[model samples]
Target: MDVIVIGGGIVGVATAYQLRAAGHRVCVVERHATVAQGATYGHGGIVLPTPLDAWFGPTFLGSRRGIVYRPGLNSSARRFAKQIAPLQAPDAFRAQWQRLRPLVELSRDAIASIEAGFHLEFEQREGVLHVTRDPREWEQAQSALELLGEFEMLHNVLSAAECAEVERSVPADPAFAGGVMFPQERTANCPLFTKLVKQVLDEQGGVQFLFGRAVESIRLENQRAAVELAPAESERKSTREVDVVSCDAIVVAAGAGSKPLLERLGLSLPFHPIRMLSLTSPIAYEECTPHLTVVDSVRRVSMTRMNQRIRVAGAAVLQPEREFAKPLSESLLEAGTALLAQSTHDWIPGAAKISAAHAWEGMRLLSPDGLPVVGNALHPRLFVNVGHGPAGWGLACGSAKVVSDLISGTPPSVPPDTLAALRVERFAS
Candidate 1:
C-alpha cells in the first residue's frame, strides 16, 4: 500500500518509518520547511508511560455526584488525589485504572524497543525524583498513587533524609518534607531523536518527504484520501495535485491541526491548546544535575540532564491561539530563569557559570478526555495517532507501531477498547 503521512513531527516521522518498514511505499508531507519544527521540537523528551487515563471513566467526566477537570493548578499529582475524593465510590476509579494501566505499560515497552533498535543515544537516565515542599501534599499523593503500581518502576516514598540519600544534590532542609522516587523513569534529547529517525528513513529507499509546503485541504474518494499541497515559497498560487500518488491511506498527525481536519470530516474533536515552556542550560554542577530526572512539586518545574546541559521545564498556560505563540516570550524567559536559579543553586551547590541556557515552547494538543485518539477515524482509511497530550514523546514509539498495524490491516496486540475508545464515533452518540 502507498501511504501519505500528513505531518513530520515525531509521531508522523515515526509512523512513516514504521510504514516503510512494513513494506508500504511511504511519503511524509510536513508544513514546516524542516522536520520536527512544531510541537515535536520542544518537548520534555521523556519516554514515559501514560501517567493516567481518565477519558472514559467516571473521574474523566463531570457527573452530578462526580467532577473532573481542574485548570491552572500545579502538578496533576497533587490534584489527582483531591479530585477522586468526590468519586469515592467502589470501582469508580477502577474503570480508569484498567484503561490506563495497559497504555502506560505498552508505552514503556515500545520506547525500550525504539532505543534498542536504533541505538538511540539520548542522555537516558533511570530515576525521576519528585520533591515536594509540603508534607501534607506528599501525604495526599500516597493514597492516589495506586495508578502507577502497574509499571515496574519502584515508586519509593521517602523522608527528606531518605531523599537526600539517593541524590545528595537535593536539599535535606525542611523546605521539602519528602519526595517520590521513580527509579525506572528516564529522559532524552527529543530534537536529536526526531532528526535521527528522519535520517534513517532517508537512508532507506521506500520513503520521501515534502517539506516547507502547507496542506490546505484533502480530497477523499472511494475510501481514499488525497491532499492539496500549496508551495510555501511560491507566489504564483498554483496548487499541485500531490505527484501521481494515490494516497491509499492518510495519517493526520498534525498536532492541533488534527482538530480542524476532524471538523472537515464532520466529527468535532474535543481538544484544548495548552502551552508549555522549556529552558536548556549548561551543566554547571555535576553533583547538582543528577543522572536522574527531578520534578520540583513546589515550583511546578522538572529538571532533566541532557547531552551537554540540563533542561528545566514546566508551566501550562491555556489561552487563545493568538495569545499563545507556541514559543517562550521575552518576559517568560526572565521569569523561568529566576525560578530555575534557586532550584539549580540548591541542587548543584558550588556551581560556576551556568550559561548557554535557551528557552523554547510548544502547544500541547489536549483532548477533552486526556487520552489521545489513535487508529481510524472518519473514513476507514483515514487514521489518527494524535493528541496523546503531554505524554506524546513517551508514547510515540508504540503509537507508531499500533498505527502501522492498523494501516496493514493486522490485528494488534493492544486491547480492542483502546481502538474503540479512539473512534470519533464514541463521542458522536
Candidate 2:
C-alpha cells in the first residue's frame, strides 16, 4: 500500500514509521524543515499512563487555574469556553477516562517495545511524582489515586516526608502534603525520540520524508486521496504550480492543523488548540535537580529533568485556532518558574532564573470529549490519528500502531470498542 502521512510531528512520524514497518510505501510531508518542530518540540516529556485523568476533569475545573479564559482578549475565547462546557460534567470526565486508560496502557507497552526492539536512546527515565502543596488539593487527588488503584497500576501514596524521601530534590516545605507516585511512569526527550525514530525509519527503507513542504489541501479523486503541497518557500509568481501527491491512503496526524485539513474534506472535528508554555534551563546544581518527574497539581505545573536540563511546563490558554507567533506572557513564565521554585524551594536556590530565549509556547490539540479521534473519517481512504492533547508523546506509539493496523487490514492491538470510541464518525450525530 502507498500511504502519505501529513504532518511530521511525533504522531505523524510514528504513524509513518509503523506503516513503513508494515511493508507499506510511506512518505511524510511536513511544513517544517525538520520533524517534531511542533508541539512535540518542548513538551513535559512525561509518559504517565497512571495519570489518565483528562484536563476537563473536576479537579482541573475546580482549580480554575488549569484553564484561563480571557474573553475580550481573544476572538475565540467565548466560543472555546462553550465548546469545553460539555466535558465539565462528572459523567463526561469518567467516560473519557474509561476510553483513555486502555490507550495509555497500550502506550506503555508500545514504548517498551520500541526501546527493546530498536535499542532507542532518548535519555529515558522512570518514575513520576504528582505532589500538591495544598491539603485540599491533596484530598481532591484521592479520587484519581483510587482510579489508578482500580486500574491495577503500580503506584504509592506518600506523605510529605515520604515524598521528600522518594525525591530528595523536592523541598520539605511545610505546606506540602501527601501525594501519589507512579513508579512505573517514565520520561524521555520527545524531540530526540522523534528524530531517532525518523533516522531509523530512513535507514530501514520504504519511507520518504518531504520536509519544508506544507500540505495545502486534501481531497478525494479517482477513489484515491489527493494531497496538494505548497513549497515551504513559496513565490508570488503565477507560473508556480501546486504539487499534488496521490496515495492509496492518507493519515492526518497534523495535531492542531488536522482540523483545517479535515474541514476541507467536509469533516468537522471538534478540536480546540490550547496554548501552553514550557521553559528549559540547565540545572544549576546536579544534586538539586530532580531525578524523576515532579508534578504540582495545585499549581498545575510539571517539572522534569532531561539529562542536565530541567523543563518546567504549565499554563493552558484555550484558543479556537492555532497561534504560531504568539509569545509566552511574562507573567505566565514568572508564575511557572515560581511554581518550580516552590516545588524545590528547600532543595534548589535561584531556580527561577530561566532565560526568555529558553521558553517555548505551543498549542495542544484537544478534542471536545477529551479523547483523540482516530480511524477512518467520512472519506474512505482518509484516516486520522490526532487530538492526543498533552498526551501526544505518551500516546503516540500506541495510536500509530492502531492506525497502521487499520490501514493494513490487520487486527488492532487494542480492543474493537476502543477503536470505535476513537472513530471519526462518532461526531456524526
Candidate 3:
C-alpha cells in the first residue's frame, strides 16, 4: 500500500518507518526544511513513564510548580480541570495507567528494534531520577510507588546521598528526601533520533520526504486519498501551482498542526494546544553535569543530559485561541524560559551555562482524556496519530505501529481494548 504521512516530527517519521517496514511505499510531508523542527526539537527527552497523577490531582491546576495557564481561565483549562477530577481516584488512575502502559512498553521494544537495526546513537542515556525535596512529598508518592510495583516496572527508591551518587551532578543543597530511580529507563536527543531514522529510511529507499512543503488540502480522488501541497518556505511566495500526491492512505501526525488539517476534512478532534517551554545550555562544569535525566517531582521540570548539553524543560501554558494566533513578545517567552532556568539552578546549581541557553516554546496538543488519538478517523483512508501530548516520544513508536497495523489489516500487537481507547470514535458524543 502507498501512504503519505503528514508532518515530519518524531511521530510522523516513526509512523513512516513502521509503514515502510510493513512493505508499504511511504512519503513524509514536512513544512520545515528538516524534520523534528517542531515539538520534537527541544523536548525533555526523558524516555520514561511519568506518574499519571502528575497531570491532575490537588497539585496540578493552581500550583505554580506545575503547568501555568496564561491570560486567566479559559474553556480548555476548565474542561481539563473538570475532566480529570475522576482520574484523581486511585481506581481511575490505575485504569488510565493500564490503558497506557502497553503502548509505552511496546514503544520501548520498537526503539530497541530500531537501535539494533541501525546502531544509531542520539546521545542516549540509561536511567532517570525522579526527586522529591521533602519527606511529606515522598510519603505522598506511596500510591504511585504501589502502582509501579503492581506493574512490575524496574525501579528503586534512592536516598538523597544515593541520588547524588547515581547522578553525580545533582547538588546537595536541595536535599532530596528520597527519589525513585528507573535504572533501565532511557533518555536521548529526540530530534537527533528522528533525523537518524530518516537517514536510515533514505538509505533503505522505500520512503521519501517532502521538505519545505505543506499540505494545502485533502481530498478523495477516485477512491484514493490525495493531498495538495504548496511550498511552505518563508521566502517563497504563494504559488498557483499545487502538487497533488495521491495515496491509498494518509496519516495525519502533524502534532499541533494536525487540528487544522483534520478540520478541513470535517473532523474535529479533542486536541488542545498547550505552549510549553524548554532551555538547552552547554554544561558549565563537567563534574557537576548530570549523568542521567533528573526530574523535579514537585516542579514537574525535567533536566536531561545530552552529552555536553543539558536541557531543562517544563512549564506548560494554556491560553485562548486568539492569544495563540497573535505573536508573543520576547519578554513573555523569557518569563517561561526563566522558570526552566530556575528549576535547573535549584536542582544542579552552576551545572549549565544558563546565560547562553537556547530557549524554545512549542505547542503540544493534548487530549482531555490524556490518551492519544491514533487510528482511522471518519474517512476510511484518513487516519490520525496525534495527541500523545507531552508523551509523544514515549508513545510515538507504538502508536505508529498500531496505525500501520490498522491500515494494513494486520492484527495489532496491543489488545483490542487498548485500541478502542485510542481510536477517534471514542470522542463521539
Candidate 4:
C-alpha cells in the first residue's frame, strides 16, 4: 500500500517510519523546510508513564484557582471553558486516565524497540521526580500513588530529605513535602530524536519527504485519497505550476494544523490549540543543575537537564485563535526562573542572565477529553494520529504503530477497546 502522511512533526515522522518499515510506500508532506519544526521542537521532553492524568484532571480543575485566562484573550475563553467541562464529572476524569495509561506504557515499549533496533541516541536520561511545595498538592500526589501502583508502574515515595539526597540540586525548603520518583521515566531531546528517526527513515527505501509544500486540501474519491499541494511560496512568486499527490491511504498527523484540513473534509475535531512556553539556559552551575527531571506539581512547571543545557517549561495558554503575545515572554521567563529557583536557589542569580533568545513558545493540539484522537475517521482510507498534546513525545511511537497496524490491516498491539476509545467517531453525536 502507498500512504501519504501530512505533517512532519514527531507524530507524522514516526507514522511515516512505521508505515515504511511495514512494507508500504510512504510520503510525508511538511510545510517546513525540515521535519519536527512544529510543536515537537523545543518540547519539555519528559517521557513518563505515570501521572497519566490530563491537564483538566481533578488535580487541576478541582483547585481553587482555575485556568489562568489572560485579560485580552476573550475569544477563546468560551472554548476553553467547554474543553474543561468534560472533566467536571469525576467519573469522566478517571475514564480519561484509563484511556491514557495503556497508551503511555505502549509508547514506552515502542520507543525502546526503536532505540534497540536502530541504535539511536538523543541525550536521554532516566528517572523523574515529581515534587510539590503545597500541602494539598502533596496529598494529591499521595493519592496518585495508588493509581500508579494499580498500573504496576515502578515508583518510590520520597521524603524531602530523600528527594534532596537523590537529586542534590533540590533545595531543602520548609514548604517542601514528599514526592513520587519514577525511576524508569526519562528525558531526551525531542527534536533530535525526531531528526534521527527521519534520518533512519530516509536511509530506508520506500519513503519520500515533500518539504516546503503546504497541503491545500485532502479529498477522497473513488476509494482513493488525493492531496492537493499548494504552490510553494518561491514557485508562486515564479508562477510555477503545482501538482496534486494521490495515494491509497492518508494519515493526518499534522498536530494543531490538522484541524483545518479535517474541517475541509466536513469533519470537526474538538482539538483546541493551546500555546505553551519553555526556556532553556546553559548550565551555569554543574552541582546546581538536576541530573533527573524535576516536576513542580504545584506550579505545573518542570525542569530537566539535557547534556549541558537546563530546560524549564510550564504555563498553558489556551487560545486557539490568537497570535503569540509578546508580553507572555517575560511572564513565562519569570515562571521558569521561579521553578529553577525552587530547585536550585543557588543557581538563580547566575541563571537570571538568560536572554529572550533562549525562550520558546509552541502550540499543542489538546482534545477536550484529554486523549488523542487516533484511528480511522469518517473515510476508510483516511486515518488520524493526532491530539497527543504535551504527551506527543511520550506517545508518538505507540500511536504511530497503532495507526500503521490499522492501515496495514494487522491486529493492533493494544486491546480493541483501547483502540475504540481513540477513534475519531468518539466525538461524533
What is candidate 1's local distance difference test score? 0.66
Runs off by more than 4 Å, candidate 3: 50-64, 71-74, 232-238, 329-331
TM-score of 2: 0.91
Taking all chains together, each candidate's TM-score versus the true structure is: 0.83, 0.91, 0.94, 0.91
> All candidates: CA RMSD in angstroms?
5.4, 2.7, 2.1, 2.9
Residue 302's lDDT in candidate 4: 67
Model 2 misplaced regions, further than 4 Å: 72-92, 234-239, 320-352, 355-357
The local lDDT score (0 to 100) that residue 423 gets in candidate 1 is 56
Clashing pairs in 3: none
Sorted by TM-score (best first), the order is 3, 2, 4, 1
Candidate that scores best on lDDT: 3
lDDT of 2 by residue, 42-118 (tens): 78787644543356555664575555544555556556566666655555656667777777777778778777889
Instruction: Evaluate model 4: give its TM-score.
Output: 0.91
| Model 4 residue 30 distance off true place after TM-score fit, in angstroms | 0.6
lDDT of 3 at 192: 93
What is each predicted model's overall lDDT from 0 to 1? Answer: 0.66, 0.76, 0.82, 0.76
Ten-residue segment with the worst summed lDDT in candidate 4? Answer: 344-353
Model 3: per-residue lDDT, tens digit, 1-429?
A: 999999999999999999999999999999998999999997788774656234543334424466665645556566665665676566666787788888988898999999999999888888888888868766766666778889888899888888887877776665668788988888889999999999999999999999999898998655798999985565357556788899999999999899999998889887778787888899898877777788887677889888778899887776765577666667667677777787788787778899998888888887777789999888889899999877788799999999999999999978888999998999998
Model 4 residue 202 lDDT score: 81
